[model samples]
Target: MGCLENLNYEILAKNCSFKETRDIVKRMCKERYEIPPGFKIVGKGVVGIPPIHVGIREEKLVCTYTKPCHGTFVILVDSPEDIEQVRKNGKPVK
Candidate 1:
């Protein structure tokens, strides 16, 4: 199953608030990309923000967003391979 689909959203929702979830996602991105968590890319102005939301589905964390200037952003991945799959499918990665 997909990472996001395997996530336990119920547990994540109960243990972490929306803000906390966003923070964790940002941190993960920061660590992965070696940049600041809120750094802007492709004119998005940040990896997580307004129109950009983060949440947990099943037992995985999910990040999605839409930007007036950059179009849309939707990424659902658990590992680097999944990320590559999403990109190969022409979807955003975050």
Candidate 2:
């Protein structure tokens, strides 16, 4: 796994829209990454589900807005090993 300090990344604004996040990923992430269809950063939450979601998709870090009232955001991880850090804190998508 690559060290966190070794990975180049930025935590996008919480107000960033899902579309904006996707666009950023496409433009920034240089690896084969996927943001699942219907992926939402902020929306109606399930009782047991978290309002904020974080995970790794295709080696890239993907996350939702931190609060229900906020919008989505993005974190650009530089290595596939970075996936481990995400999984430690959240679940993985299919």
Candidate 3:
């Protein structure tokens, strides 16, 4: 089985490194989404686009994922306001 096949989304959200998440996003994500106002960017997979892996909006966890032959996707997962790992590791916009 592939690495992603075994990877758990909740664990990935809580513990994976930025490099690991970025790699996954790059391979799967083919599209991007708009970052709404006041959201803090936690991880960006690729350049020049709206797609990202993690973010904080209104005290929630926003994550991006992709499905084979289905297209890239974004979602808001329930989480505490202080997931320090994701918050600290994210590459913020300049």
Candidate 4:
């Protein structure tokens, strides 16, 4: 499997809908990385399932409007390694 670093967020934004992006990320994490069972489409691809249903700003992939996850939590991305640093922002993991 390829690394999440190779993902092209801009291309994914142009090619897929938000739901598609979310599904792809979840599936890839499960199949390729052995990380599964915990993922949701929060605002701005927020991961760890924040309680608030506050949808994030849908501005391309790396939406500036999306706020950080509640209290240092992480947003979902392509790679497990960068979940805390920089999320895939807007892109599919596959």
lDDT of residue 79 for candidate 1: 40
Residue pairs with backbone atoms closer than 3 Å in model 1 (clashes): 6-59, 7-58, 7-59, 7-60, 8-58, 8-59, 9-58
Off by over 4 Å in 2: 1-10, 35-66, 77-94
RMSD of 1: 10.5
Candidate with the greatest lDDT versus the true structure: 2
Q: What is the TM-score of each candidate against the true structure?
A: 0.27, 0.40, 0.39, 0.24
Give the worst 10-residue stretch by lDDT in candidate 2.
41-50
Model 2 scores a C-alpha lDDT of 0.44
Tens-place lDDT per residue, model 3, 1-94, is 1432333334223233435554554444333233332344233232223434455555555564444453444444454532354556555532
lDDT of 2 by residue, 1-94 (tens): 1343455655755577666654554454443233333432222221112233444445666443333566554654445543554444343333
**Candidate 1 lDDT for residue 76:** 43
Best candidate (score: TM-score): 2
At residue 19, candidate 2 shows an lDDT of 60
> Which regions in candidate 4 have their CA more than 4 angstroms from the true location?
1-14, 31-81, 86-94
Question: Candidate 3: misplaced stretches above 4 Å?
Answer: 1-53
Model 4 TM-score (2 dp): 0.24
Q: Write the per-residue lDDT of candidate 1 for residues 1-94, one digit (tens) a residue.
A: 1333453222222234335545655654432222233433322333443334443333343454334565434444344433343234322335
Better of 1 and 4 by lDDT: 1
lDDT of model 4 at residue 70? 22
